[model samples]
Target: MDDGKLARMRQWMLTEIAVETACVREQIGKAQLDPQVMDVMGEVPRHVFVPAAFQAEAYLNQPVPIGCGKTISQPFIVALMTDLLDIHSTDSVLEIGTGLGYQTAVLSRLARQVYSVERLAGLAREARQRLDSLGYANIQTRVGDGYLGWPEHAPFDRIMVTAAPPQLPPALLDQLRNGGRMVLPVGPHDHQALMLVRKDAQGQSSTRVVLPVRFSALEEGEAADLF
Candidate 1:
C-alpha cells in the first residue's frame, strides 16, 4: 500500500477500533502507561495481522482468528501488557508465541530487540516475512516449542507469552533477568488469568493477576522425558 493509502487505513483503524471511550481512556490513564504506548496502539495496522476475510473487524476491540486456530489478542489486552512491562528503548523482549506477528510488530516499535517463538512452522514463516516486509528489523522469529522458552538468549528484560500454560514453566522463570517482568496467561484453556511475574533485583519473584482471559494452551514437547 502507498503511504497515502496506509495513512487513510490507519485513520480508519483509530476511529473504528482504537478504544477512545472515556471509560477505557480512564483505565489506560490509571494503568500509568507511557503516552507513547497509546500512540503506537492507535497507529499499528491491526487489520493486516488478521486474515483478509476479517479485515473489516480488525479494529473492533475484540480478538480475531488469524489461522492455525489462534487468535490475535484484543487491542486493550496488548496495550495493558505492554504498559505493564514498562519497557525502555534498549530492552530485549522475548515473546512466547508469534501468532500472526501483530503483537510482535507492536513490540518492535516499543523495544530495542524482540525474539519471538511460534510452534507452527507456517505461522512462524509468515510472521517473519510480514515483519520483514514492514521494515521491522528488530523482531527475530523462530519455530519451536514455547514451553521450553528460548534459552540461548536468556536473561530477557521482558517476556510475553501469548498462550496460556497449565502452570508457570520453570524454564521461563530461569530465562528472566533479575528485575525483569513476564506477562502471560495462566490457567486452563477455558478459564485463565493474565498474570504478571516480576523478578526483583535479588532474584525473588512476585506474581500479580491482572485480568481474566482465555487463550490456546501451551503445547508440550513430544519427548516424554522433557518437562
Candidate 2:
C-alpha cells in the first residue's frame, strides 16, 4: 500500500533473513550476510517483481510465484546467493534465470553489468520490460536456454543461476574467468544443493555445497537461438 508501510515490511523481512542466517551459521559459515547485500535487498522492491495478485505476500521471507511455472526465490535465499557471489562494483555477472527481474535488479545494483538468460519467452519479455521500467540500465535479458549460458559475454566475473541443473554445465565453467566465482543449485529434481564454484588464476576450479535447496529445473530448447 503506502511507501512507508512497504519500507517497514522490507526492513522486517531483512531482519528475519538475518535471524535465519544465524540459525544456520554452522552450515552457511557466517552469522550475517554482507552489509551491502543486506542494503541492496532492503532497497529492492520485491513487490513490483510479482503479479499484483501476490503483492501482499511480497514482503514475506518466502518465495512468491511469478507465473510461467516459476517463483521468485525466497528472500533469504536471494540474500544468501547474492552474498556468496561477493560481487564487486566492476564485476560483470551472468544470471541464468531472470524470473521477474527481482534478482536481476539486485545484481544491477551490485555489479557493472548483468547478462540474464530466461527460458520462458513470456517471463523474459516481462522481466526485461519490468527492469527497463525501473531504470535498470546495466542489465540485459534474452530469452533462451539458460543451460547454454551467454557465450557472447563469456568469461564473466561472477555468475548466478537460479534454476537447478542435474549437474554443472561445462559452458558455464568455461565462461567464468580465472579468479571468478559462480553460485548455483545443482542436482536432480528431488534433491538439490546450492553450490559455489571458484576458478583460480591457474584456471583450476573447486566446488563446495553451500546448503540444500530446491529450484525449477534448468530448461533447454530450440528457443535458445532467440536473441
Candidate 3:
C-alpha cells in the first residue's frame, strides 16, 4: 500500500480512537486519556497487524483476530494499558503474549527496548518480520510460555501482558524491577479485570483493578509449546 493510503487510514483511525477515548472517560467518570497515549494510538498503523481480510476493520474499537485464535487488542484497551505503564524513554519493557506485535510496536516508541514472548511460532515469526520491516529495532521476540516471562532479562522497568492468566505469574512479578509497574488481565476465562501491579522501590508489591476486561486465556501446555 502507498504511504498516502496508510496516512489516510491513520487519520480515520485517530478520529475513531478520539471518540472512543471520550466514551471511555464518560464510562469511568474520568476527565480524559493521557495525551501521549492518544498520540501513540493514532500513530501505530493497526491495519498492518491483522490478517489482510480484517485490515478494513483494524481501527475499529474492538479486538481483531490475528490468526491462531489470538487478537490485537482494541485501541481503548491498548491506550489504557500503555498509559498505565507510565513508561519513559529509558525504560525496558517485558511484554507477554506478543500476539501480532502491535503493542510491541507502540511500546517501541515509548520505551528503550521491549522483550516480547509468544508461544506460537508462526505468530512470533510474523510479528518479528513485520516489526523489522517497519523499522522497529527495539523489539526482541521469543517463542515460549509467557507464563514464565523472560527471566534472562529480569528486572524489567515495565511489564505488559497481552493475555489473561488465571492468576498473576510469580516469575513476572519477581522479574519486575523494584519500582516497576505491570499491567495484565487476571481471572477466569469468561471474566477478568485489568489489574495494575506496582512494585515499589522497597520491593513491596500492590495491585488494583483498573477495569473489567475479557481476553483469551494465555496459552500453555504441549500444544502451546509446539509452535
> Which structure among the candidates has the greatest lDDT?
2
When sorted by lDDT, best at the front, the candidate numbers are 2, 3, 1
- The CA-based lDDT of model 3 is what? 0.86
Model 2 C-alpha lDDT per residue in residues 1-227, reported as the tens digit of each score: 99999999999999999999999999999999999999999998899999999999998999999886789999999999999999999999999989889999999999999999988878888888888888999998988888789999898999999999899999999999999999999999889999999999999999999999999998866553232
Of 1 and 3, which scores higher on TM-score?
A: 3
Candidate lDDT values, in order: 0.81, 0.92, 0.86
Once superposed on the true structure, which residue ranges of model 3 sit more than 4 Å away at CA?
1-5, 26-29, 222-227
lDDT: which is higher, 2 or 3? 2
lDDT (C-alpha) at residue 194 in model 3: 92
Model 2 stretches astray by more than 4 angstroms: 224-227
Highest-TM-score candidate: 2
Backbone clashes counted, model 1: 0
Q: What is the lDDT of residue 141 in candidate 1?
A: 86
lDDT for 169 in candidate 1 is: 91
lDDT of 3 by residue, 82-195 (tens): 988999999999999888889999998899999999888889888988898899988889988888899998889999999898999999999999999999999997789999
